[model samples]
Target: MRNEKKKSFYQEFEVFSKRTATSPFQHQFCLLAPNEEVAMVMAQENFMRREPVADIWVVNRKHIRTLHPEEKRMLARIDNKDYRTTKGYGYLRKKWRQYEQKMLDEKEILSWGGDKK
Candidate 1:
């Protein structure tokens, strides 16, 4: 059928881009093309047409290594680590308030940026 032929005309191509000189390559999305030349030619207009793309790469889908469903399940984390976060020190807000001093929350601490004057 015509649909089958058109399907074969466009193989899956993974697109990637670099936003800036020091930025790392990132996966954008996938498209379909018949060959590497077609994939490369189509990569820009198909994915980065309206974005700032410093670079691009079009790879065949079969060349990618992806996590399996079971492997993906291993990425889960437990919810018992509140002690490792600011939420654990939430009482500091009330304590600081009692002292008539503002709580040095995350936004304030990050703004310090090595100069605490």
Candidate 2:
């Protein structure tokens, strides 16, 4: 062993991957390396050794910007906005029953536009 001082080469990195083009990116795992390029290479062998990988991303933990709790509170949304969801339209179901008509929700309506095959 050489009697020399060693630098802190390993840094924290977060990894994300996706299996297909239409799939959303999901968190895989983290790795430690000297830089992002090396981290990516290391992640391929460690995380995706068996499965297929469409995309890969390695983000340095230090470079990631995050908001504080107060900032997150500022972005909080209330559930009172019934008009944004199906809750506001729920009354129509009872009205349809009164008229002896079937009520169609989002899924039923969307099924009409599905592939013909």
lDDT of 2 by residue, 1-106 (tens): 2323223667889999999988999988877788888998899888788799899889898988999998999887865787888888999888878665444455
Worst 10 residues of 2 by lDDT: 1-10
lDDT of each: 0.83, 0.82
Displacement of residue 15 (Cα, Å) in model 2 is 0.8
Score candidate 1 by lDDT: 0.83
TM-score list, all predictions: 0.60, 0.67
For residues 7-116, what per-residue lDDT tens digits would candidate 1 score against the true structure? 87778988888988789999988887889998888887676777788888788998989999999988887567877988899998888786654445655777879876
Q: Give candidate 2's error at residue 73 in angstroms.
A: 2.1
Candidate 1 segments whose C-alpha is farther than 4 A from its true place: 45-52, 99-117
Question: lDDT, candidate 1, residue 69?
Answer: 100
Report clash pairs, candidate 1: 11-33
Displacement of residue 117 (Cα, Å) in model 2 is 49
How many angstroms is residue 98 displaced in model 2 relative to the true structure, after the best TM-score fit?
A: 1.3
- The best candidate by TM-score is 2
